[model samples]
Target chain A: MSSWRKLAVAAIAAACIPAALGFAADKGPLRLGTTPTAAQVEGWAIAVRPDGQGLPAGSGSVKDGDELYANVCASCHGTFGEGVGRYPRIAGEGKLTGDRPEQTVQTYWPYATTLFDYINRAMPFPSPHVLPPDQVYAVTAYVLNLNSLVDDDFVADRNTLPKVKMPNREGFNWIDPRPDTHDAACMSNCRPAADVKVSQTAEGKTLTPRTTGPLDTAMPQ
Target chain B: MAEQPKEQLRTAPSSDRRRLLRTGMGAGVAAFAVAASGRARADDPSPPADPDWSQSLGPGIGDRVYGNPSHFEKDVIRRNVPWLTANAESSISFTPLQYQQGIITPSSVFFERYHAGRPTVDPAQHRLMVHGMVDRPLLFTMDDIKRFPSESRIHFIECPANGGMEWRAPQLNSLQYTHGMIGCAEWTGVKLSTIFAQTGLKPGAKWVLAEGADGAHMARSIPLDKMLDDVLLVYAQNGEALRPEQGYPVRLVVPGWQGNVNIKWIRRLQIGDEPWYTREETSKYTELMADGKARGFTWPIYAKSVITFPCPEMPAKGPGIYEIRGLAWSGLGKVKQVDVSLDGGINWTTARLHGPILPKALTKFTMEWRWDGSPALLQSRAMDETGFVQPTLTELRAVRGTNAIYNNNSIQTWQVKPDGSVFNVQLA
Candidate 1:
């Protein structure tokens, strides 16, 4: 009777093994879950398109922006939007197309949306993204006004922010278009096969490679 | 050459003692001269030799407890541009590649590139919350993370824009700016898989959003597959707590991904069905191709290598029996081979690779060369274990048009002048 009972328990355990494995395999690779609500997610979702797709519904005049700039942005970006230190100045430094030229926002930035996007995402010296949407718009407007790209009365809101035209819109070009060109000079025109040159200088005089007589056997073992 | 004279001046007698000694020597020598003048005599004249290192300070204080590099290495320092970015906040500085030798960049001298600058985060207040499509939304403290089984691996983290300057004409003429956005460290952390297992991942979760506690609140959406496969919640690097510049308290170490995606000061990990489409995903990091449409989700940085020594502005020391050294890394895996070409790209010689060539880690390569004072163009080509070869600048431009400013990993050439000065030059 005991043997029969043990057989029955074994039979039951065998039946449950596949089911447990199947249940584990059914769940795909990653653990999924719900995201935060729109309000809760607002802090992480601030992407303004060139056409102002995700701009918030808030408005601020250029005058208000100017005042806000003086109080906040001007300390580092300069009163007239000229950059101090590594902080990029807003006003134009003209196009620098030399071999090595500074790529500043005023001279090389392609879109006004980038300015708005960057400022909205990462700004202020101490606290980043702590500003409300209206303040971001106002600061953007003030920077634009200082850049001479916008009017004093121009109000930057969800609609007007995208319409601002930057001067260096076409400043950047795409990567070069060229096939991998292998130089014949490297392939076939390498310096003629000559004997390896071995020469040295001692006391400002050139010397040829010549082994002296006898190896030093007195060296420590 | 000028150092010998300076050393002599330093070793000379003190100013006050030298004056007194000179007066005494003059009086004695004059008296001796009068005696010697009367009788013909011959004496040898020679200056005393300089003293050895032991004569000064006898190994100095604290020598028994700690050791430092030779005093000759004092010139090595991390370089930065003061006026490049405004203020200490939201700036990027470069590493001095020319000054470094090995594949591993010392934590102290590692380059710092911050968006909103380094944030002072208190570890006690730090909490990592994992929510979303899981059976249980779990919140773990710094101590709670330590309880889990941990693993350590040396990995190399590189910025996607490391070689951005080379996308156009060879802009800056140094490997430091061209390739300094990379660093290697032995990171120790708990596997994200363990954490995901505790949360009980639900079916259909595809992406995970990792967020930081910095002022910028930097965040990025990583594919769920990669997260479960190899992601790590690293707390220590090089056997020490994470450096403040790299990440302090805890950071999400995404092996073989862009530097920005390895979010520092990581606070939240939300598992989701689709990407969050955060600003970083939609606008930034996306490569704007030559075509009007942009290429989104260019995640894995490709294999790249740069010859650090004998680079432009770093002259070759009259070239005979010189060591050719550089760094090679790949987002894919170990660097299988690195070829050094001295005569332009004519003959390729395999370099001797050093260190444990682990997956997604920097591997140092070296080769010996004998130069004969002739102008030679030097270049390095790295091939990863994945069979992906490092291409030339011309080849990179072909696939990714000249318009793109990021992910420019091409074989860089440095023209060595006869006088030993090297200049950045492109070989077609």
Candidate 2:
């Protein structure tokens, strides 16, 4: 073959090799094809933010909420939301800090809208959505009243629901100390020689040390 | 001795000799002799032997169309907390993994965690509504869903918080309680993409909110990219209508995602431009890290494997040769390999994986070990197709901190004592 022709063929082969490899890499992992349209994806969006971004438009009164709560929620949630067994108690509980603290709506929940959104979406035990929008509003009002967050006559419609501030609203904070550090306290200082007297095991039986000699070899003379 | 008796018999009458010999024997021998003589007196007699119970019962019928687990498994049933939540209206139950063998948790024995108890929905009346960011909003009936081309894949559905009890301390005694919240089944359903194709997708659609028909109206927002990737509107599990506990008429089978996102008793699919901050996506499934920052939208369950046998409850019968068996799974992809460590994490031996190692399915793995009855900590680690290795407890804690109660797929260790007692232990 001619030298020029050979050179051309080799150059062409080199170019084709990379293109073939790129195609194979692009094929990548076996994946399911895309089918869901962008519009169909939007209908199910229902997240509510602490800043009230996704709060729906609705309202209810604390008095009506109390009546709805008695009929639907009191059975399992206890008369005053003390909770029974696995069901969480939602009222009259303080911050879940200190010893023997209770985690309830009054103590733990950061946003009042969370209760409204949760109850509206999944509440009242059996036959969900059996209650209309107004009843859900009333139930939220009643739950808030039970928690002592709102007055008995306060209305809890969507507009008023977001306005009701929870006691533990400032309880949760975004405190991410990136790159954590742990240091041994013994590294810096040691007790005085007279104060560092070793004690023998009880009954004059000494425990076998897991390691030989002193734990730290470096010491100030 | 026999010759002297014969000579005496000859000296006396034959009948008298015989009586004398019988009297010389003990009373018991004489009674046996009498019985023998009586039997001899009869015309014919048969030898005695044990009776056959099967012959009396007769041969059993053969060949059944559908089979149940052995009659011995009558005690194995899905048990629920009677008053843990609500009565039948809303409740949760657990699968009896202690009584189960092999990796596949029977559909009947599969655990159920329902916000509202199981809902009884007629298949005919069941409708799946798909609306939102789409060119056309379409509602599909059960029959309409069946008309589409269906794909059957063996996948595992696991609750993200399966090991929630062990987040702070080793609270559960058995692996069944700590890791029983998972089950594998051959799911047959139409791909969510196929349905998505029917309604042309809009440009900005990024998420899909799935809702259930149960009393809780359980809902979760799934990323649109994930739905387009590998999601199924599963109608059948293990070749039958999903067990009532799973999802009777239909359920969204999100492969490798948390069990909660696989919405059971599904009735709606709303597509949107952004995540619908549903209670499930924000308040419930969110993980509050030790750093105080909540980790939200953490969907994919990482690679996790556990040694089921020789666990805390079921210890090794004795030292000798034994089979160390367990299950390994990855929600992100297929489980590539599982390595078993006998001496904490010092030395790892590859376990023999069995069955089809399908993507997002529970792959059963086993290994043979000769226990010397010495104190040892055993654990298993899994690697997935994406090159992600199962992290150790310390490694996981280093990243996510100690406060989160979700996605804890760290290697679990079981400490075995000389007296055949196994206890849950953490590797230092």
Candidate 3:
């Protein structure tokens, strides 16, 4: 039998024992999940959106963020938010137009709330989800200051966050305009041989090691 | 380039080729087949020999509680492009697609993407909290979750940036590097809707913030409609407990969506009215368009297919009625049909779909091919049940431009030379 079938049989057997022992068997939708207190919710539920809905009641200044960023984020994100080794540059370039566009906070991101949410949840590379709300706010402010979106002393909080307009605020479209190419299921003579051109070629990098051998090699001769 | 391969190809009928696959022959046997085909071909073996029976059966059964792949399959592993990330913790790895067979990808080498690296979580201590807009905020232990109605379904989790590296140019060399950010497996778990029904979602609960228990606390705002659709709070992958690299105790499996949104080490699910606009959704997964504008919430992976054989890694071994195999899939729905092109996009022929072609799962396809030892641009075009055919590289670039890194599910091409060598190439 399949493993899932075995698991289902085992689960049924486990559930029956409770009723057989004359214990109060759980009812209604398996009766799983314990009602958690407000304190329990406070331990992990932290997420901020574009509308500043989840922004905590805390204030932070870009000036304070600059010092904190240097002490914590500079090693990986670079002192100027220029980025070090592919760690994502928070500033410098803006609004990708060139062939190789640098997708930084100042240029690409449509919302400032994303900055606050990311830093609080996943940041600093080595350690994450440890930053207090104020530090996250300060860093968000500092990143915005670097992007020239806000002044250095600008304090960001729940109310002030939604009001801060991003440069690419209106730079996003909704509908997925796909099935763009109208290449029919042409069976034969679709394109001329001369028309076909080799546009790009592989870098020839040996990314994956080749597997070609017996399981066991050496033996005690 | 070699006389032996051409002569062997002329001698062997197609039935012998099918027998080779059915026997589950080792690489040496396959190598001998290739060697008999040609000396210039890959795996140029010296000669076949009888097994040294005295050396065999050294280790007894039950020696290892958890078994691993054959020692020869050491190279069949997840690999990384070192230059992609600053540290290994926040890096991603590619699945060995060319080495894989059928639909299910082995749990061990299923591509890994870690935000704060794989967390070592004790299942006993792990807890799943469902709060926010729910009528009753609930916390469920591992044991409590298993009691819910369980489901087992085969689905594929694909990273949106599967072919993102080759957006501008064909950079990677192998099939694994190009289309390895995907894995299909039978995931067994409780449906999120089943769990949410008990929580009783409040009136305007449109979205839910799925959070992870890892150090990164990785989070993504998923639509309730999607959560109710097919999303799973998975604890087991394939037939065993989930690999630590793929969220051990619990993880959210957002079927048909980008892999990132399927948060690993999932801890909390906060039902809310609006999207959280997390960094993952905004800065990372968003697609940058041509007009300097960007598009967000672009989730579903479109129709895509790639030639597994004759790929850079596994080139045509002096081609003789070879079973040209590959994988075809679509996040939209089931793959309705797949067409193979031998001469770029000039001519097309239907390839047979193998195994159970389930929705949102990898579908294996094969075609009987007789290579004439000529330079050819080979490609596969996949069309889903939704009638959305996989776009060509040129067509994809024309619409999306080279900037949109994620969701490059275009038809991939493998240029096979007369010498039986294959190179990744883009044709116009």
Candidate 4:
């Protein structure tokens, strides 16, 4: 093919392909997926909202929850929700201030619905979303009772779960008022020279992973 | 994260284990030398004779259908802190930032953060559902989603807890551990706007709850405004199919937002009238304040910068004129300027920003400095286009306190000793 003819041919090919491809999209969105059936949607509709939306038809007592929690979650969360290993503890002193405030279910979690949502959607470690809604509700109620947010006989259903008011429900500030710090790009005398003292160092802490020399023999601290 | 603050740190191994570790390392080195027997022997003439490589033809292309970094670069792997999580399956790993050169983090060493374990999802069976408050609820197969208009964008996905460990002090001793919970990569996918329009969002659809198909069913509620602006349903990253660690077949890329919001192995995007307040958002990602009140929906990653070359892992080799390199970024906008401080924050010099300076992407910065063999505190501070400067640790603590274990973008300082060794440090 001649160079001029090849250029003309290439232009036509390039122009035609996108125009054809974009025909549906230009009109609107390139609606590619199928409109799912009610059954299909139900299979994946697992989210439970703060207002009690998306809750399934089931209930569980704190008694049942305690038994279920022992069988399924005790290995990591501990017997009394005190936490095991590096796993987060479920119980706390209901305190939110200190050198290191423990933000457990008792102290920080604001919504009880979130407890049910998380347990139903993801729980039981290595294997999650395996529990039925009844079991999930039971576990959620048990955890609520542990946090002193519910009575021992209290049950968590689609109706009751959202009504369980948490102690720290009003403790959160919703908006992020960032640009919170006002450190400008000052070139000189940003701070006094003496103020640049090293407050502390990680040298003697032995926390750093070693790279070479005899220090390399040491394992991670 | 599961244990108390102090208990979360790894205790040193017993001295007997250290002796065993030394013995194990010696054997590894000896094995490596034996494996490299085909290379030119030490006795086989230095410059007088050509090396074995020049004498023999190299392996053909078919030897490795998929290419990898050189064997010498084996040390450049993502490493996880032992005490960071309950198990390796649901933990975080740090990218070796000291070894990284440019803004784009290689997929092999990209930082990893997972709520549950990494799921081996097969694309053939994977389904992406868009339901809830929409005109036309739909289910998309992988191929179906890819057929729409697609674009590739380079943006950095950062875990808000990137520097959470050092909220109070400089505990983590390396740049990788301190700031490696982020990775900037080229994400190629269809825009959420394109898909949402197809789904035809109904009125009052204010939030889109994205959920992953991983074992944890990880989910987060993102506002509609941000979703319409830059959210993408990404399947390809860095010019290839997404790495399994980075949500293989498909994922959601909420550029500039907290990394947890970028749902990996994404399966569902439920358009809703209100936020679901999933476990990640309510219990995990929220930042606490000094007055006992916590802050929820803290999304944007503020301006931040760190000097990589003089970090603990990459120490100053001798004291000569050197190009100090670092990375600066802002979740809100472009990194406008980066200031390098040799003697801590007392004196500062502007660094030359290079590479693609795209908004919400990692920007590389370089500055020339001469180290006169004297001990110095090295620091870098970034200012974004929004006029928000990276704050000092003192400034952040005065407001947010040490307990807010997320969004610690304070100025990182490295104490360079006179002997050319570097250590992580905090300014008084």
Candidate 5:
């Protein structure tokens, strides 16, 4: 009896989705999408899982990465992977607990495989995903080395990249405990009107747009 | 005392701000002065017997078949802060909220947040490949998607880091920069669950990794349960094919989630067991707390609002009887009530919800204020049906700290000077 019930459920799922659409359907399975060929699916499967499940077969060393980084990434990521103009700082042991915590990979990133996955899929902006697997592995190794997360002569591959221990790996395990701060919808006597003070304005250095002068007409005309 | 401003009773489905400008009434040029936000002075020269438009035969109708806003609205385009990103191509721009009146943000001027530059995707060439953990992997074209039953619903897509710059201080002077990272639109698309029925989920399919076709290939992992709940593979917005910037051919509309999760130019959705902690999920978007530890997957936008009329861009003009208008929204559910405060949140008065108040969508709220030309700090607090009251900046920062670059839904305060000029300011 149980076997028949299981088969019955599977049959309904394989048939048309009458329940999902809130209507009756005589057609068996709306099946609109084309059955993809293996190559068609493989061409777009670029995501790299945390366990290094999708890492392409290739390897590179810190030494090779240094040269490759200079050639392709240095223009935007800076020579030492510090950063350029407004580009993000790639490599550094920037502190996390500060007024302006520098978001460097070594300090903030949770997984080392993320670095490889990102560089493999999207890197060296203006011409992203142009790097071969070997170059991506090399660039990944050099960036990890620049942050002192790995040794000077470290090599990175599918096996090695997943094993790399990010400093902030365990830092992101907290559940988002929100409605974090709950405030009552207070009506009156919320606070003394005199207490409110303009602690800060956009007029702070380098941030000012317009203060007292005629407001820049945001008028449509 | 003056009569309490009448609540503009809304019977129709959708009525925007520009059309509802009859709140202030007068006659002839004076009426124009009152209605046009004092743009045309009442004392200006009276109109001639026939104006140029009325006298002359304008350009033919063929000149503008695909209609656009009046020429006067040309300046009301998306504005970006240059200092925000390393390159302009991968950056974001803000909606001119001060000029925008209705709850539904026009598709053309919708705020843009693209990881890679916007791609002009051809629907003929585009295909959405669904594979990985599924009973039958399939490749869907635009026609294949539209073949399935479609749904149209209104929702707002807000970037998680909408007000990141104003975390430590009120750093952006303009309302567009501070609060314009949100846009509401009526999206038409097939529900992902309906399509997933064709490609049944495999036994271990716990998550779905959605990847975009942008140069960045921006990908984010969404829980399978969420995908089956309300996710839509959208192709149209606001009664038309979606604007190219909003993902022309198709995009993922993870209703009520951050804009990033609503992957634009979506090409592939690989159902999987584990979350794909792509560059966007881990290296960015995660909210870094005060302890240096960061919170991951902080998705829902809490109740939030801002007084737009007296904001930096739309400052008050000799504050008389003016309709104080603003927008409020929540990801949890429909906005239950919106309270406006002229004195920096010291007290609150419930404002009238002006238009259709949909779930997980922008709800326009308005309050009439007879200003006495006094310096006041204007603020609005939104409350969702979930009973979550919008918290102050102090309350928000106290829990998340000043470092949470994402999910800054704290109430915003606009300082109205005695001269009727408004500026962005944070109360101490």
Candidate 6:
């Protein structure tokens, strides 16, 4: 018999042997785990991409989102999404290139679906992934509305979320234009003496929080 | 060790006895012994009932269920700047770089960054589900994952926000705060390709979504090319099961990449044709460029180095002849060379790099400097095997501005004063 014919016969036998047996054939020496069903896959795969992929069937209006935001998010993220304490500010617009850029869903986020995705996955600060899909859409809509990206009564569903154009949609690219800064390994006399200056000092700054005791207090003095 | 305050020394019981002895014997052997004992008493609060620990019967085996660092090494610890974040649960802590001796960071002092807090996961209950665009979907338990062929490699895991605090200005006043958001470890795990081979990939599968089992379910989409390259499904670090904060049950170790992509408490990996553009990729880790345009998927950490000795926390005593030591690492490959500068960027000298320079791991570098107690600016620059030289703070800010807030691997400068105190400084 030809070599190709023998390989085809072996392939047929390999496929038939699995059907002949009652279980799925092991690919390696260790028959490690069971094959998961589609239902099991859906239960754990919850990430929603920029193209609205993996979104569950749900919808929420901006009015409902405002109410939800007040109850669950207002403490950490302020009533106006100004952000309290170290929580991120979620509502701002048009200062991406400024000295103090107020990066928010409106100003810096490249896609609207990210708001929905982030809210669905991790939100409410104290609790995460507790809100149902509808509330996630509503909260996303409310945050966007605060930045004037959507109407107060705007409804966000899978179809509408992706279609809603974000202000910075065209602002991002995947190209890495790095190795951007270059410093030569010059041994001596690399630059003129007059060009050097100490631009900043952290003299009186209190950066780290004071711990209860010094880290080295337990060590020998 | 810091010097004891004069007030503290005066109040100490041993010092009181020593003062009496010195008064009795004005200037002689008794006075010298009293002074020597005073210094020793200051270091050890307890009076020496016995000579030393070697003579005493220390606790035998199994006295400690798990071993700990010696009592004298209590200063080596993971420290956090509490005000940097909203709360402890969603914050970052730095490695004690000044105290670390070699390339591999001890499991205890490794820096930690978490979106949510570290989860206490039971290994037996943990399961990793692999599905989507595969010939067969598989759900493997932790025990089953260990059955696969395994390999051990030493690599560095660094947060792109390592030197981010210095972007706006020289804000943090210590080397640990400036360059300690990183740690190197000997990771033991099964190669990602081994798992991929078992669950055969379908045609057109190009991306893999790695999702963690933490509260945030932290997720990132890694390209298939990277998965096939050097990524490992790690279960152990530094010869022991991973610590809870380091992703105990299981984690993905993406060698040579930034830390965020190496998701901890990893539970699911879904193969797909396109990237998942997760929230981390879009809102958090993306580098905001100077021209209002943001750059996504800026994954690899560049070459970076910083002088650990004579830093803000470990200033020189008198500065005669001291060996300046530091760590240099590169994601692309092993570090080729490191240059030490005593007078800012005007002059540089090649530092001697220590042995066992593994790829993608921290390489130790040292240089002997003779200081005349003069005020000087000290800096260290690293060059990776790729011939990529580390950049200066001025050079980096010229291109990236102060807003990127991530991937700041610029050379750090420490200003040494005439009094031998070192301060974190930014020179332009």
| lDDT to native, each model | 0.66, 0.68, 0.79, 0.83, 0.82, 0.81
Estimate TM-scores for all models: 0.67, 0.72, 0.86, 0.89, 0.88, 0.87
lDDT of 4 by residue, B1-428 (tens): 33335333435433433343355533443433333554555586564244333322344446579888978676787876776666778888888888889999999889988778788999999999999998889999999988988989999999998989898778878888889899999999998877876777676677889999998899999877677666899999999999999999999998778898899999999999899988898888898888889999988788899999988888878879989999999987789999999898898999999968988999999999898999988999999887788988989999898899999999999999988889989888
Give me the candidate number with maximum lDDT. 4
Error of 3 at B337 (Å): 0.4
Encode model 3's per-residue lDDT on B170-249: one tens digit a residue. 88788887899999999999988678667776766678899998888888887776776678999999989999999998
What is the alpha-carbon lDDT for the whole of candidate 4? 0.83
What are the RMSD figures for all models against the true structure?
A: 14.5, 16.1, 10.6, 12.4, 10.0, 9.4
True contacts kept of each: 0.08, 0.12, 0.62, 0.65, 0.62, 0.58
Full ranking by lDDT: 4, 5, 6, 3, 2, 1
lDDT of 4 by residue, A1-221 (tens): 32222433553343344332234446856658898899999999899898999999989999999889999988889888989878889875656787878888878888999998888777887788789999999999998888788999998899998898888889888877776777567898878887679888777885656442222323432
For the predicted complex of model 3, DockQ is 0.31
Give the per-residue lDDT digits (tens) of candidate 5, residues B174-257. Answer: 888898899999999988877777887777677889988988898999877677767899999999998889988899998778
* Stretches of model 4 off by over 4 angstroms after superposition: A1-31, A210-221, B1-35, B38-49
Q: Which scores better on DockQ, 2 or 5?
A: 5
Listed models, DockQ each: 0.07, 0.08, 0.31, 0.32, 0.37, 0.32
Total backbone collisions for each predicted model:
18, 31, 1, 0, 0, 0
TM-score of chain A of 3: 0.77
Estimate, for each residue in B215-296, the C-alpha lDDT of model 6 and write its tens digit: 8888999877677667899999999999888998899998878999999999999999888788899888988877888888
- List ranges where model 3 is wrong by over 4 Å: A1-27, A203-221, B1-50, B54-57
Q: Give lDDT for model 6.
A: 0.81
Q: Write the per-residue lDDT of candidate 1 for residues A37-117, one digit (tens) a residue.
A: 455444444545567655777877788787888888877778877776545556756534333343445555556666666
In the range A18-120, model 2's lDDT, one tens digit per residue, is 3321222344422222333445434444445445655556667877776677788877798899986566677895534332346566665667777776887
Scoring the B chain of model 2 against the true B chain gives a TM-score of 0.83
